[model samples]
Target: MRISDVLEKFDISSEREDYATIHDIVESGIVFKGTNLWILIFAILIASVGLNVNSTAVIIGAMLISPLMGPILGMGYSIATYDFPLLKKAFVNYLFAVVAGLLTSAAYFYITPIYQAHSELLARTQPTIYDVIIALVGGLAGIVAISSKLKGNVIPGVAIATALMPPLCTAGYGLATANWPFFFGALYLLTINTVFIGSATLFTVRLLRYPIRFLANESQKNMANRWVTFIVLLTTVPSIYYGYVLVQKENFTQNANNFIQNESFIEGDYLLKTELDANRKQIRLIYGGKTISEEEKTRLSQRKNIYGLAGVSIIVQQGFSVSEINKELSLSDRYQAEINRLKSELSHNIQQQDSVIKAQKLGGQLYKEIKPLFPEIDYCSASKQSFFVTSGATRNYTVVVLGSNQPVRTNRDLARITQWLKVRMKSDSLKIYIEKTAI
Candidate 1:
């Protein structure tokens, strides 16, 4: 069947009369206006916190909250229905969402005390063909949900598929870190998502048989053929390039993973994370192991060349030993330094907040009762506000009591002390010690 005739049978675009200027795209659409910017910002903040805490739940929450899907989806509808003004509006709205999401996340990360990079952010920095697949699948599903009757809990599915928040957060990390690779990789992810989702939506619309009116009259159909030809050609070139690049990436990853898995060095001796940037012809290998002997290094280099990756650069660190691995696991030097810097910040803030004294008193009272019940508890020092103790089941507890006056001279004190000690020991074992109780 001819494409136009097929579309007519399907009845794709439900004709709406009030379609006007670009602004009307949002002003008239289902998505509420005026709140787009705020919603985007709020989603970014949630995403930023999620990345910092390494919490997937929070990240997904952010994705569900993101206002990004609207404008882009609107763009697809406009193009499919041949609403040029709405298309322009949708395009502009999508741009605003991107910019707003980036800035909001960047500002949050820039000011936050946390400096550690979470898995979510790191995962976004590396764009693979897998991400494109996800976006495509997500786009198709989202459109299906929008158009169909089975629209229950589509937000969760969209969260998994679209992955809108991570890239924007990565963009923020890139800007804050001044890491060009992060910046570009994140940008590439956003680009891939846009292309796939936009394409998926277009293809779905076609499948749904959306009708489009040729600007030319039926008598002038021949004249409109050139314009159609130009449009198809223009769209097909980029799509072809995108597909080719995606395929190349998949091939590279498969080859790289196979090579790594087969390598002798990887057999229970090391854990490796490989990142391949096909465009840059670079592969980064982060692995834990002892330093390779000269012979082993030579073998590795030979393997790289054999894999057609001769120009790739490698950085190897020896981290097989317990101490070295511990050091490697430590937060980044910069992050630790920042934490130390916060001590002064906390000290200053503590003086301004009255909760410090209350905290100290709680510590004192808790410690005072802890000493008498567990003989293993050790109290090395105490003041009117707080006390300290060292206790372990293996050792007799040494308890030091700190109070403004003296220890409570009653059975109530002993009972409370016993309860406190049992909780501390995580056992109900019998033990008692009346170590130095100072006034």
Candidate 2:
């Protein structure tokens, strides 16, 4: 076959869904009627459960089934056709749907026993340039597929990729957990998806030459067109700016990943965790094994620009010493003696490490003041250890407090102090012990 013939056969626009049919599909998702309302609530519940349990499959299922995309497309149709009444209707319904999703998910998360931020949930909280691209593409694909005579799985797949449900659920989790950052980020992502999807639909409708919803005089038409242009322009400006920022972040993150891979040594230290704050232009790395030397630190610092983080600051934290744990295993026969020794040494070591971490976060001046507080307290510091009991019926997060030469306070006073520390540490499974400083 000729290349022209082959191209003609695959031309999507030739077989695009007629305006009437496309309108029907978009109209179905615009209203919050009985069935749509029920489905939305159900989808939100399913998404919330998926996020709670960190289940990717369940989340995808929720996304595919969600009615959230309906109002989004409806809004686009209204904008493209210059139907002010329809636009108002669709906008209201979309707001209601968002509120419903957020409320449903938030209610679910509030009572759940699990409060941990799992990977599946965390994924939705951060919106990047890639997410905007996915959202825009998904919106375009969805409208095109809806327009087609036969839509196999294109709409469903787009729904999954765009992930409208998960972000709402994530925002709910943040609200329930009182995590403002999570709430803001997830909500921001969700808003980005919604606005872009509507925008994409408008573009597609205009391209398809869809009939206008209402007839108007020439002056009225001009005014309507001006308003549409104004709205589109208003939306486009921020989206473009945020998109640019997201692209920069994605590039920086990609380069940082590459730099880390290049720096990894097979027999030496390995990366454990990385916290990249793109806005602050800071990279924090947690490494296991030996601490990085001054020379190696300089080498890493020098390579920041090579890794696309030209103005970024780098902080590295090494794992705490494991000699105590290793040596304690060998001296198990002298368990009692070593247990006391190990506890003291471990607590001191943790204190030093904590001091260093705090220093990096707060500053060197903060580290200097920590020593003076040592004389006022009866304990050097505290170390947290978790393990199962002999009965295996329970696990304990024991907080070993290394005692100093100062007076041992009353039990009530100590209890209050421990409670204060538990709040500061954000752990409810905490148990405190005030052991005297080992000789």
Candidate 3:
């Protein structure tokens, strides 16, 4: 077959909808008039519930169904076509939709039983460089898919990836809970999604050479251009800074984690809890059984440069043992006090909302997965300790502490278990602590 025929047979670019057609396609979705308004409102509720329940599937469905992307795409279209009227209309509608979304989510969360921000919610709080990249790429895909008659299959995936629905819900949760840091952080995330996605669409539309329909007067056009330039700078500069901060945090986290892996585990030293404060430029590691020595500390400090840490402070916070209920040994008041402090600090925000259900499922899964590997360890307790992953994932890890005196698993076994958890949990950060104790 001919090359053209071959390309056509593949149906690539053959099914593309034209410029005007694409305009109409997105334009039709611009209205929040009657049923569409209700759909958006309902979608907000669904998204909020999904976040509340920490259900990824439900949130994806909400993102797909929500019309939040319509106006964002329209704003991009207006810029691409230089239609001032369309831009104004789309902007107003977009603002209104945002308010509607935030309010709906806030109301739902206010009345709902769940108060804590789970993995789903926390994931949206800080927009990373990767999110910007995804939004940009997703926008391009969305525009291309829209420009193609083969739009149906690609659009939903774009919606899910773009995540147009979740940030607003997260912001709403923050608002309801009065967590200003979370609220503003989520808003910043939403802003990133909005700006980059719209920018990408505009880029795609210009690339496709979409004609300027109903062009503004020359004077008005100049004013519009200036305003657009200002808006672009306003939205983009902070995003660049935020992206930079995210990268720094990510690097700091890696170095801190490396330090913990190398230095935290000693003959008599084990980490009770470790806190990395990016704002304070410090890593506070709490150890149990024994405090880290000055010589060891000096060694860690020297390796700081090797680990990409130069100015960051490393504080070896003295910690008490986080031991299980040891029927073997009755502890004194001092030991009890230490344990209490350790428990309080380590367990801080350890359990989030809707974790009860998750714990049950994970418990079973951990046992099943671990049983085949080491059948000797009679008791295996797994709980998750999660913080923001700084960039991509939920930033969560499963902490599996095996309680047994005779561990058939060696250090190699422990390493293998960690790898298994990482692979199984899809989390790169897994902590496995072995407590040598008799039942």
Candidate 4:
């Protein structure tokens, strides 16, 4: 349908009289207060630990336990039905939850052994149009769940989409780390999520015609409606502005990614940092590489969305190279060929060396038929009267033939030396070869 038709469908003018009052809606959520509060606390604590340890599973578990969705939805219903008293209650409760969640997570982070921030925490610090879209869609779904006569298992699904706890924990981590930008960015993300979800819920409630049964004075009802409009505007303006900011961030990420894809650049050799602040209208792209040229800048500027983003600063610095890009590509075709040649040469040399050594040890004709009992000796010095044999992978052998002129006296002595060598080698790949050298 057209935009006009869609708007009309959700508009208050199109709403039915069976609408439930904000008071009743708020009352329903209160029943879960103890359960919600405990869950909120648990989720925040788990999220805080997840941020500290960088565990995604822990953070998700915390998200499941968090009871934050209720108050946010409460705020939406209060506004939709023009119930000022209910609205006030929701606003206060929501504020309390946000503060409690943040403080609890921060306190936990302060005491946790893991000081390093995880990817999950960093992910929360960036708000984009995509986040607004998620909140909007989730809000509609949450409102639908509340209004439906058939209450299905929507809580698990709603909890994942609304994502109330992770951002709070992320903000807490930022506070603990004393990172001002991280704290502010994460707070903005949380704010965007709340406003969009609440507003979307209001829109859905108006569309679905959920009953407003509580009677009120005409004057009070009018005043409440006016107040709701004002509050909705208050939430909407900031969200629209932040959506613009998200656009700028998208541009920066796209440009940075494009720069790295150039044939002259090695993909994994450099790290890119793209920071775009829409309020400041400043975009900064820092990359580890030799100086980028005017051509590269022009290529980035070619992006239509990026062109609108002003104050763009690009910094490229020198970094180590694993291999030059052009040379690496050129050699790739011959890589397997080179490897095979090296392997064959190595195998042939090993066979020839063993044959010569065996013949020389044989001496006149069958090498005096003396079994070379200890082939693998670490160090041997006949003059010093010291023979040190180390353990090989297969067996350990120590040959302490006291008189260097003769091989180890007994088969048992030779076997003991082999065993010793094997234990010393500590390698599963090695085999024991006993060789006796004349003193």
Q: Pick the candidate with the highest TM-score.
A: 3
Model 2 agreement with the true structure over 128-147: per-residue lDDT tens digits: 66677888898998888888
Ranking by TM-score: 3, 2, 4, 1
User: What is model 2's C-alpha RMSD?
Assistant: 22.2
Q: What is the TM-score of candidate 4?
A: 0.54
Which stretches of model 4 miss by more than 4 angstroms?
A: 1-26, 31-33, 214-439
* Two-way TM-score contest, 1 vs 2, winner: 2
Order of models, best lDDT first? 3, 2, 1, 4
lDDT of 3 by residue, 1-439 (tens): 7899777785545576876778788888777878889999999999999999999999988988988888999998888788767888888999999999999999999999878789999988877667878888998888888888767788888889989889999999989989998899889878878887888888877787778887567887788667766876776677778789988888889987776655444445545556789778898766656556788778767777777778989887653553632332345633654554455444432443447768767756777778778766656677777766657566666777776667645678777767877788787667777777856
lDDT of each: 0.63, 0.75, 0.78, 0.62
Worst 10 residues of 1 by lDDT: 380-389
TM-score of 2: 0.62
Backbone clash count for every predicted candidate, in the order shown: 9, 2, 0, 33
Scored by lDDT, model 4 comes in at: 0.62
Clashing pairs for model 1 are 375-397, 376-396, 376-397, 376-398, 377-397, 377-398, 378-398, 379-398, 379-400
lDDT of 3: 0.78
